[model samples]
Target: MTTKSLSIPLDFPFPSPKAHPLLTLHSKIQFPCKFPLFSLPQRIQFLRNQCPPKCQNPNDNNNPVPYTSQQEAHFTETQEAISQFLQEFGISAAESNSIALNSPKYAKMLFDSVKDLEEWTSWKSGGDGNEFATLGFKEKVAYMAKEKGDNGKVAFLESLGLSLSSSMNVARYLHGESLPNLIHKVKYMKEILFSDSDDKRLVGKYARCMMMNLSIPIDEDLQQTLSLFEKVEARRGGLDMLGSSEVTFRCLVESFPRILLLPLDLHLKPMVEFLDSVGVPKEHMREIFLLFPPVIICDITGINRKVQALKKVWAFDKDFGKMLLKYPWILSTAIQKNYKEIVSFFHMEKVDKSSVDTAIRSWPHILGCSTSKLEVMVEQLAKLGIRNKKLGQVISKSPQLLLRKPQEFLQVVLFLEDLGFDRETVGQVASRCPEIFAASIEKTLKKKIEFLDRIGVSKDHLPRVIKKYPELLVSDVNRTILPRMKYLKDVGLSKKDIAFMVRRFSPLLGYSIEEVLRPKYEFLVNTMKKPVEDVVGYPRYFSYSLEKKIMPRFWVLKGRNIECSLKDMLAKNDEEFAADFMGF
Candidate 1:
């Protein structure tokens, strides 16, 4: 229900009847004595008895003068009620009258005192219904919370000028999660909520729902936020898309709470439709919407261009579908513009098309980097006397080089060069596993090197270990390396067997036990009838794309009565694989 603002007059003997139970301090008059609650007729009789001769009824001398205006009538009736109510509270009629008006100086003070109590009573009783009379203040609050829910309670508390934390405390206390201490705080908040004229929105139930449901507070900031929202909503096709129902409107607010304050036509619509047009599919749209709501409302044309370039220009494999599911924010990056330039720059540097595509598919963001950022480092490598085809090989093998600052790569190269490594040997080490350059000296690389040293990989054999798999320097001792080593031990590989595997194919340590190694090992042993030790003889087989290449080819071969070993089955490219298995 909507409550209108109380427009009580200065001379009115009583506060306005429509006044909220929460209003306090009528400025014009005050009553010294406490006033009792009285019925309407008793109030009228008291008014007639207190009527001055000049203000008395002229035609019917028995009745108080009929008020010429409603304000005067209400004033008369309220004055009478105040007089009788004071008398009922054990205030002598004479003393009440004296306090009511005897001293002209105290008249306003008396009237104010009377008005304050009346306002308090009205709020507590809630007028005609007196719904709050049976409940204490906190109980009343709890009742409101129970009946109206958190949103409603929140609106009520906000109107009171209480902080949200205080309201939450009250809720927690009621739920036995907190102790009570916030009564005075609640009162202070109530005063702030009710007395502030700027917050008229707190008066009506509908307006309260609008603010509460969306967690908006009534304030000057709200006005600005909502003003922008309305402007956006009214844009060319915005209103048509947003529609008119409050339910749908609230749903939008719930889904993207911050969208209300964002620009609509320019920021929200274009990127949303771009994703839709590019086959992002309807089911995954919510994940995109909720995770990156601002995507629909971003300067995302660059990101869109990247997606377009991947499909049209770069001829990126149809793996984009899975990439979106894995990295929804990829479409929000401003990388495509730089990516195109970098790819072309790489082509000029003798990086082959197949190599560039392979590197990009493995690390899609490589194309997003600007070539200029890496030119100094590439030039420095050429200065190291590794140029042309060799330089292309270095970059293709470690496209992550583009991601690092030039100084980072320069330092790593210089650090490797100081370690008595020749230029060619340094390039081979970096190309095999560029992540070593980024691995921490004190934290990651030193710790892993110590572990390998204890495993009997002598300092002489260390270079061979690194040459076999540079990724070992970056692999976690506890999380990746130790766990995989533990799994191999659990599968009956001794320290010697493990060291031999690490020396031959250290890439095996990079595959996760849970995600890659264990599952593939179980599949080969149980389904393909391969022995576990034979599987361990070639741990590199675990690194193959199990779902994409291994399983599909295995199932096809099983159907065709083909008995190829695991290596022959998974080693071929898709075309060679199809030709071998299906005789295409």
Candidate 2:
């Protein structure tokens, strides 16, 4: 039967003509001044207690709010008649009584609202009414209870400014936790959130910001979160976190609030214990978590398995911690599976397993990349005729080559190729100075080419100069190269002479003025008694060892009292020099 509105029958015989028994029950069962939120079952218990055993309305005979589940007649209509008939939108019975006594029109409007709730709870909204209608009376009641909860949670998050589209996103990770438990968690988080600061910032909107910018926790308790912070605060490396342990804990909560849900005993302690056992230092723990916050939640047993597998392969049982310190993401990724692929690919290419381990030890993030990604880098290098063991050596020298986009890696190769290097010589340059592959094409490499051109290495000489010393692509122009040039020009070498010397050696600009150029040039002038112009002719003089080759051979020439040019003296093989000078 479908009655269109909320109307008590003309023959509701028990209560006064204007009085609604549902509203009158508000005064009968007195709750405290403070009202608490209730679940569906809890609110229904209030209904069952207040609703009379029988209340009849004999207007003709149709129920004004018909239930799709006819069995609702047994529990809701006949059993607890007035309870299901009143306004139920957070209205305590007390609020209902106030409306009944003072406002007859408002009471009638409240009565009319029950029709919508009745249709909604009885499978008329989205479910199969025919199928729901066949369920047992108690089963139908349970279904309505769950519907209220689902709607309430959505309303709660939406009220916090989470869009309806994304309100469920944070809930997905919570794994079906109840709404009351979520409220309990949010309530405590609010206490900690404003206990120190942001209290004044969000004073007028305290409840609104309690979700911590809508990254709310759904499955944890306040004590659970506090215990996790306590464990982190008490760690030996605890001080390394933003000064004090308490502030560091707050920083983690601020940056990665999901850390609140990770259990200390299961994830935090086990991870720290495993790391300590594996020789990872206590001082590095906080830094590791901050660098890769996901590491705090990674499975300790799985991480230990990866460490054990790596130990078997690298045989660097204690040294493995160094790799972790370099790239903490190794624990967060598929380290074991990726390492196996790296080992197999290197083995197939005839590169040693030790070389693979060395590559990972230097750039452990490569162990996170798939073998297919590594193969793409290899194919790119192979285009420059770098293949087989040469390929492996290039990768070990610069694992970042494996990390670059194929286009980014190719641009660097094309930059070299455009400089007139044949593919094979380009491959040789890559092998010798693998760091060049990592240089930014526009910012680092182009700026370097411009510096070379400015220093009198013309278009014709640029390729020859870079191919001779690929470190030119990687060296800092102002910090390393320009200072060396400035020192050379300051030391009585003209721009022309500096240009000629660098054109000859190509690495002259890359040499350290303090270490190599100054010490060697001082010895050449003061002790060996050579003219400074002598180096322009044989600038490769710097290439020879100062003490072993230059000093020893010059002393020989001085002893024999024979005159020789810089090249004639230092360029000859030891055997040739001895035979000629000693008359052997």
- Give Cα distance to truth, residue 506, candidate 2, Å: 1.1
Model 2, C-alpha of 262: deviation from truth (Å):
6.0
Error of model 2, residue 557, in angstroms: 0.5
Alpha carbon lDDT of each predicted model: 0.51, 0.58
Residue 77, candidate 1: how far off, in angstroms? Answer: 23
Residue lDDT tens for model 2, 527-546: 98888889999999888888
- Candidate 2 residue spans exceeding 4 A from truth: 1-287, 290-294, 297-302, 317-319
Per-residue lDDT over 1-584 for candidate 1, one digit per residue giving the tens place of the 0 to 100 score:
11123323345333221332213422322221222344545543343333333333335546654444543444443343333433443555654343333221122222333434444557553343343344433233223223322322222222222223333333433332111122233333223222323423212222222223232123333343344345434544443322222212333333333443334345444655666676666545444443333454445766666677667655754667555644343453334445556667767877776666666655554533446655666676665655666666666666555566667667777765654576788767766666676555667766777788787665666766777677888776777788888888887778887887777677777887889988888888788777777665666778787788788888898898888776677768889988877878
Clashes of 1: 16
Best by lDDT: 2
Off by over 4 Å in 1: 1-258, 261-294, 298-310, 322-334, 357-361, 364-368, 380-397, 414-420, 469-471, 475-584
Deviation of model 1 at 172, angstroms: 35
Candidate 1 achieves a global lDDT of 0.51
Q: Cα deviation of 283 in candidate 2 (Å)? A: 6.3
